[model samples]
Target: MIRVLVVDDDPLVCAHLEAVFGFADDIEVVGEAYDGAAALESVLRHRPDVVLLDLRMPGIDGLAAIPRIRAVDPPPAIVALTTFDSDHHIVRALHAGASGFLLKTTPPRELIALVRVAADGHTVLSPTVSRRLIETAADRHVTRGETLARLAALTPRETDIVACLGGGMSNARIAARIHLSEGTVKNHISQILAKLHCTNRTQAGLLAQRAGLRPPRPAG
Candidate 1:
């Protein structure tokens, strides 16, 4: 089962998320926290596979708690929660090691699927968010040359995999497009992350985007 921790200052939101996960046989709600400080504590106690974390809280907000939670041995994947897709906090959270961000208004089914994706060590960016993040990187003036240098360590195959990541393609889709097995794609992703010095796929994807990498065309 994929263990999940729901963290939000609002009790209703936490309960709602718990109920949503209840319907997914593959997912379990392991714990809940009302604030970031408690989130850190709960993460240590429950050791969840994925954490749905609210960005704003009474104390030690999600932004501050993300890096702390991620510092734990074998940290869980963290997906930030926000009311607005354009929230600046999401970008900071991503840089702080969050796997991705999800709008609070996401449908229950999509939320469940995203949690499962996070548990599987994949990113959870919606196309809108992905485009905004790429724009954010561009706004920061992360020149293509700089990103290219960072990706220089990758082999041609790894480059293609990272490009798939840039397009937010899951392992299955990437495998089909690249004519590789899902297991092989997963392995390539791992190597890609290590070579790029990225803690998660979100970072690698952003790097790929900054470098203007495009996914390989589908095979005829």
Candidate 2:
């Protein structure tokens, strides 16, 4: 089972998320927290596989809590929850080691799928949000030259994988696109993360985007 912890200041939102997960046989709601401090505690106590974390809270907001939660040994995957797709906190959260961010208005079914994606060690960025994040990075002066310098450490094959990651392709999808087995793709991704010094796929994806990399076009 994929254990999940729901964190939101609003009780209703927490309950609603719990109920949504109740229908997924593969997912279990392990705990809930109303603030960042409690979130850290719950993470230690429950050791969830995924955390649906609200960005805004009374204290120790999600932004502040993300790094702390991620610092735990064998940290869980964290997906930030936000009301707006354009929320600036989303970018910061990703940099701080979140797997991705999900809009609060996401359909229950999609939410469940995204949590599964995160648990599988893949990023969960929607295409639109991905574009915005890339743009935001550029606006913040994350130049292609700098990003490319970092990407230079990767092999050509790993660079292709990073480009696929930039497009938010899951391991299975990347495998199909690159004509490799899923296991090979997963192993390459692990190597990519280590070489890029990224904590997760989301960070790698963003760096790939900042470098303006794209997946190769399909062969004729």
Candidate 3:
């Protein structure tokens, strides 16, 4: 079962998440925390597969707590839950080690699916939030020349995989798009991780975005 810990200052949101996961056969709500301080304690105790974290909360908000949670030995995938898709907060959260970002208005089913996808080592972003991130990244100063220099070690195919990762496609989707078997895709991802020195797929995705590597458009 996929263990999940819900962290939000609002009790109603916590209860709602609990109820939603209670109905899912593959997921179990392991614990709940009212704020970031409580969230740290709960994470230490639960060691859940994923954490649904609220960005704005009373004392030690999600943004401040993310890196600490990630320092835990077996850190769980953290998905930031926010009401707004503010570029500032989104970039901060991702840099602080959040694997996914979702609006609070996301439907329950989609939220569950996102958590699953994140726990499976894929980067998940609400579509609008993703667009904002891309726009924000485009305005940043990560020069293509510098990015290419940093990625000079990658093979051409590995670079292609990185672009797909930047687009937030999962291994199965990348496999289908590149006409490779899923196992081959997984092997390529492993090599990409080593080449980029990224600890996880989320980091690789962020690097690719910062490097301005856009995946090719699908042929109609």
Q: Could you say which candidate leads in lDDT?
A: 2
Q: What does each candidate score in C-alpha RMSD?
A: 2.2, 2.1, 2.7
What is the Å distance of residue 96 in model 1 from its true position? 1.6
Compute the lDDT for candidate 2: 0.87
lDDT score for residue 125 of model 1: 63
Ranking by lDDT: 2, 1, 3
Report the lDDT of model 2 for residue 5: 97
| Tens digits of lDDT, candidate 1, 47-106 | 999999998898899989999999989999999987867636666888789998888888
The lDDT per prediction is: 0.86, 0.87, 0.84
Q: Write the per-residue lDDT of candidate 2 for residues 1-220, one digit (tens) a residue.
A: 9999999999999999999999999999999999999999999999999999998898899999999999999999998898877646767888889888888888888888889988987767554465666446433666789889999999999999999988878888888898999999989999999999988888898888788899977656
Q: Count clashes in each candidate, considering only residues at least 3 apart in sequence or on different chains.
A: 0, 0, 0
Query: lDDT score, residue 178, model 3?
Result: 79
Judged by lDDT against the true structure, how good is candidate 3?
0.84
Q: Give the per-residue lDDT digits (tens) of candidate 3, residues 1-220.
A: 9999999999999999899888789999999998899999999999999999999998999999998898899889999999998777887888788888898888888888888888897778876575757446432566767767878898888888888988889888888887889899899988988887766677677778778788766656
